[model samples]
Every structure is written in structure tokens, then in C-alpha cells.
Target: MPQAVLDSPFGQMIMPALSRQIHANKRGGGILGIEQQTPGSSVKPQSQLHHPLAKVHVVSNLAQLDELLAKFQKSCAVIFFTSATCPPCKTLYPVYDDLAGEVGDKGVLIKVDTSQAFDVGSRFSISATPTFITFLKGQQENRWSGADPSALRGNVQLLVQMAWPPHPHQALNLPTFSNPNAEPVIFTKVPPLSKLLAKMGSTASDPAVQSIKTFIETRSSDGPAEATLPDIAAFTAIIRDSISTLPTDLLFTIVDLLRISLIDPRVSGYLAEEPSHRTVTAILAHVTGLPPKDCPYALRLVTLQMACNLFTSPLYPDQILGHPELRRLVTTLVSTSFLDGGHSSVRVAAASLLFNVALANSRRRRDGPGDVLPEEEQVELAASVLEAITQEEGSAEALEGMLLALGYLAYRMPLEGELADLLRAMEAGGLVLAKGRGLGGCDW
Candidate 1:
């Protein structure tokens, strides 16, 4: 929770404004749509224990059980019907929870205390305690009456396998595509700060601007541990104020400064936590609003670089994926940049940003509850990547980046969605095969 500090002779000039801005934006709300709870202030509600993502959901009534079943209609589900006084049922509780955790988003597990939920017991015709039922795609697949842990585990595992069968491609001997690197491609090279700042001319003398320059220079040379952040609030305020007044040609200078500083997690984390995301929003909104043909190449390139750097903070992936306005702007920027044939560097940078976005969404699907990127956006990105690949006759680096980005987006996606259909319609497999032939032994 370290705030970015401003240290310079001009600190006095911006202190009052920064304080006022901070006080004005100070309001009670949670970050990333999750409410922040103070420790020891309140206990979590029992309802939260039954979250969709929780390992085991304890239903209180027939209605609650029905709702959960409806929500997971597309996946495997298991219902544990037990009585409070059933001694045998207690033995399988831990085993059931462990199985739920192992299943993750692939299936749902529900525990119903029939002793209290008499309606549910009646509805399901449960005459015996410790009865278990397995469901696949909403159909009753199997039923048994027991507290045997081995039986419960095996049945649930089998149900999950039935729900999501392994893709046939997994059996292929393509070692190159089996496990593509999940790491995001990032731009970390630091440019000469003194010379870079000189491009700003008189604006470089502004206290906020100078402080950011010092931060980037110190962090670049000595690393983040030795570098204290600049007053990000004040720096952001300056950028906001200058957007309307700064010449279009000169704006990239300030944006490049931010792009370099954002390489540090501390800097990017602060911006990500800002309630309005005003600074980052202002910069991207203005740049992307311009006609693609008229947008300055330097500004566009650095802006794309800054977007990639935002992924440095663990907080930002959620921000980029969950925030609708930000997600749209970023997707637009990336999709358009993919076809920027005039600038291979711009296309490469766009490919890297796309990879970061895909990598974030991929990890969410793998480790968390569900995908943050909507299917429509996924289809749009895949189409753009396909077009880029077909047109890519140069820059192996750019081509590789595009291929990786597409691979992540398509990874584990259900074969029934629009993304899959589009891939089929476009003959994506044939396209990739053609690209491979052109590359001639490129391991890809």
C-alpha cells in the first residue's frame, strides 16, 4: 500500500492540488467488484459459503438446490442427501469436499441435509439417509444409497469425464503445440530518459513530469527496490490537464514516460487501484478515438506498450478483463493494430498485448471460476488474429506472437461456441499449416 511519493523542488507546487484530488476521489467502494472487508469487523455470511465457486454448496431448501442445479446444467453435478443423525454420512464429508475442489469449475457438488430440507427429500423421493445422486448435463446418470467414500469419488470422477471429454488433439504427437508457453510477452527495454524527456521541451520542466522521469530513471538503473515511486496522482492530473492543450504530435512523449514507469508493478498497481482509472482511461481514450490513419505511430506504439505493461501488476489483469469500458477500448486498439501492415513494430506490440490479455483470461479459466472475456470478444479477437496471420508475410517475431495469442484464446474453449465455428469456417488449421510450411522447420 505504498503511495507514489513526489520528491523534488516542485513538490510544494503540486502538494495542495494532489491533496484536494485525493480527498475528492475518496469514496467507499471495493476494487475489482469485490467488497473489501476489514478484518475482525464482521463475519462472512453463511450464504457466501455456498458460492458457485466454493468446493461444496450446502443447500438449505428445495428451491436453493434447484437453483444450483439449473446454474450448472451444462456440467456434471452431484447431490448428497443425508440426515443430520446419519453417522455414516459424517465419514464421507471430507472426501466429498476434496472431490469438489479437484473438480473445480468442471462440475458442481451440493450437500443437502434432508433432515432440515424435508421438501427436497420429498421431491427427490429420498427414503434412505446417505443417498447420493449424480447428474450429467442435467440428466440423472446414476443413483446409490451409501456413505462409501470410494463409491462417491469414483462416480463423481466418471461423471466429470463424461461432461468434458478430452479433446482428440490431446492424443496427437505434436509436442510443439501441446504446451505453448503461458508467460506473457512483455516490452521491458528502457530508453534514455534524459533524451526521451528532451522531446517534451518545456513540458519536461513540470514538477509532476520531472518526478516521473526521476522514478523511471532510478528504477531502470537500480531496480524497484531502490526506487521510490513518483507522485502518480499528480502526474496523472498533469496528463489529464494536458490532453486537450498538448499538441497531438508531442503527446507521445508523456505517454512514453508512463510506458517506461509502468514496467514497475508498484507504478502499475497504483493506477490499477485508482477508482476511476482516470489517467490510463484518458490516455487510451484520446489515442484510440483518433482515426486509425491519423493516429500518430509513436503514440500508438507507446500506448500499446503501456497496455502490455499494465499486466505487470497482479491487480491489472482483472481490471482489464472485468472493466467493460476498459476492455472494449483495449480490444479495439489491439484489433485495429493487428492489421497495421505499414508498421511491423506496431503489429508486434499489438500481438504482445493480445497475448497478455489471452494469458490472463486463460489463467482465469484454468485456476478460477470462469472466463472473464465474453465469447463475442473472443470470436472477434480470433477473427482478427486469423486475418493478421494470413496477411503476415514478414516479421517472424510478429507472426509467432500472433500464433501464440490465438493459441491461448482458443485453448480449451468449448468446440461448440462461435469461436470454434469461426475457426472452422476460416479453415484455421489449414492456415496455420500453410504458415508453418512457409516458416520451414520453425518449431512453433
Candidate 2:
């Protein structure tokens, strides 16, 4: 029942995004795919769940892994979901650690990058970091991959109850999907994790990341930049001096490399792994397009980290902020992050990225040679974030960050009372109620 998700790289890699969509499977075994929703499928949705929080690191060396696991095992339930370039893993991980905290005595939460534990992940049937296999009494249990937190909590509680029965309680129920007015709301679709979902059962050499290779070949400079280059030799070095320790998917590597590279830009132009800033933006454009994939959120977070590392070059973010694709993506992330999602953690993360992007856009506009666009667009970028904050007023995370952004912008540009008024209302006791209630909400 613990069949790993090797056959589906996109599914494996984007499981973090998809993890939130998981359904319970009681017919036994793991909750890996949408077979339950498949046409003519008789197997009812099972009772499996994805509640534990996991920490995943794609390591190529055992020494590093041992260092992490040693410390991790001593702390909590760590199910090491792993695989070679597990693409969907990040989608699932954002909450892996949170879920792990609930699995007391049920297991330890951990992950082993398949590249390092090829045999371990493979032997355990864990073909991806998005994989979930519980550990109890020093033994691993069945593997599952679903996005249902309640189901996961239920199952884990059951496991705990079986080991040490507690007073009987009611089972968790799934949320019902009801049509709201049928008012024709625009639906923003998340791009499929990748074009390789159907190819997971195929060989690892599948043409899943063909674009990645081309991307790297095109954007890659002649060599590394001397400035901010890091000692990520471990990340890029060859394993056993033979096989590439490098990830099979260029996007995965880019995401990871960017995270580390951002800390130091002296390694400038080395990461154009796709060609001009235009192409780099395009690649990430594909990523951000998948708002649910967390690519937009990931790009902004990565941007903040890498912004400092970029040499005096506009090519990178120029393509980014200028790209309608990325802009649209960020907008989607800011607005629907909570509206479209039920998770607070993800909403916070999404809002954080939105705030960063808006600030970056504001800063970029300020740096331009000439003033362009009416004062509206200038304030638009920042105002939208403020609007999101106003909507999310009750949320300390969203309100505080947004209020700060508004404060910073007001100080620099001199608000014409609108921004100032909202800022004051937020600071006063009414912001939270004013949030969803509208500026009209604080009409007092």
C-alpha cells in the first residue's frame, strides 16, 4: 500500500501544493493519486491523511543527512519522504513539520533526498520527498500522499488510540462543496505541476525536464561569477566523481540554487541558467503561473533572498517585475491566497511574498530614469498590497506587514489622505473589523 511516487515527478515535486488537496483512502494502502476520482472507479476515497509536518532536504551526501537526521530523530515524528529531484515535494513540505508535531510517539518526521538514499527511499518504496511513511517503534508504517489534514489527524489519532486508547471521540468529516449563488466568479486555475505526471512509472531518464537542460545551456554564462558565489559545491558537485549529484530537473535545481545564491550576488549571471533576464523570468513565469504550486510565493521569497546577491543588474528582476506573467501571478497570490485557500500558514507565506514583490516593484519604479505612468500605477503596486492587508486586518501577520509597507510608502511618497486614513484606521482598534468590512467598515 506504500507505493512511492516515483512514476510521477510533477506529482512528487508539487505534492506540497497538491498535499492540501489530498483525500482519504480507506480501501487500504497509500493516498497517492486521483484514482478515486477516476472514471468508473469503484474504490471509494480512503481514510488516509497528510497532517504531520516534515522537514525535507535534498542531500547528495550521507554525512550531511546523518547530521540532520541524528538531530531530527531525537525530536519528533519524522517521515522521510524522498526521491531523486522530487518535484512536488515542496508543495507538500510547507506544512510537513506542522503535521509531524501531532504524531507524538507515533513517529519521527524526517526526509532523505533520494539522491543520497537511493537505496533507502527505493527500498522503502519512497520514490519522492512528497512521500509519507510513518515510523513507530523503530519500524516504518504504510506510505501515503494525500492533502487532507483532518484525515491525516484522524488516522494518526487512530494509530495513537490503538496503541494507547483514549476516550472515544467522533471521526472527522470532510468539508462539503456547495455552489455559492452560481454568480459566475472568475476561476484562476493552477497549471498542472508539470507536463510529466503520466511519466512517473517510466524511467528516470524520461524527458520530463527537457526544457531545463535547454534553459541551463542557454542562460548559463561561460563560468561562475566571482562575487557572492557560495560553497554550494556540495549541491552541484558530482557524486562518486561519476554520476551527477545535480538534480535531474533544472527547475528544482534552480529553485534550490537560487535560494542559496541569493545570499551572495557576487556569483552574478551564473544563474541565468536559462538565457537573458527575459528567459530567466520566463522560466520562473512558468513557475509563478502555478500560484497553488507556490512558485509565485517561492519566486518572491527567492527574490528577497537573491535580490542582495544580484550584481548591479536589472536583467533579473527587470524581467520579473516587467513580466506580465509574473505580475499576474503575484496579484493572484495576494488576492486569493486566503480566499482560494483554507490554510493560514500558506496564506501568511503567500501574503509575505506579495508584500515583498510590491515593495520591490515600488523600489524599482523609484529607481527608473524617468517617471512613467500616472501617479496611480505608482501607488497601485503598493496600494494593492495595502488593500490585501486591509482585507486581512484581523490577521496579525498580514496586518502588521501591510501596515509597515503602507507606513514606509507614505513616508516616501506623501499619501493624499486615502493611504494615510487607512493606515490610521488600521492602527486604531477597528482595522480587524474594517479588514473584510471595507474602509466603510471603520466609518466611525
TM-score of every prediction relative to native: 0.78, 0.32
Candidate 1 minimal-lDDT segment of 10 residues: 1-10
Global Cα RMSD, each model: 15.9, 23.7
lDDT to native, each model: 0.76, 0.38
lDDT of 2 by residue, 1-444 (tens): 001211233224333532332232212211111111333433223234333343334455556545644643422234545554565665556555565555532334456676666666556665434656654433444567755556555655554444333211101111110111111111112223233323322222333233333222333433334232333333222211212232233234343333433333332345433343442344344543454445444344443333333322334444445545544544444443434234444445445544444444444323321122234333443434443553463466545545444432332232233333333322322433344243331111
Stretches off by above 4 angstroms in model 2 are 1-254, 268-276, 291-345, 349-383, 391-395, 414-444
Worst 10 residues of 2 by lDDT: 168-177
Error of 1 at 254 (Å): 2.7
lDDT of 1 by residue, 1-444 (tens): 001112322233334543453324233332111123334433322112222345799998978988989888887799999888999999999998888887888778999999899899998999997999888888999999987788888898898878877544333332333443446666788888888778887888999998998887777678788898788999888888778877888888888888888888888899999977888888889987887788899999999998999988989999999988888888888887876789999999999999899888976654535588988788777767777787888888898888878867766565555666556555566677667555543223
Where is model 1 more than 4 Å wrong at Cα? 1-53, 201-208, 229-231, 276-278, 363-371, 440-444
Who wins the lDDT comparison? 1
C-alpha displacement of 116 in model 1, angstroms?
2.8
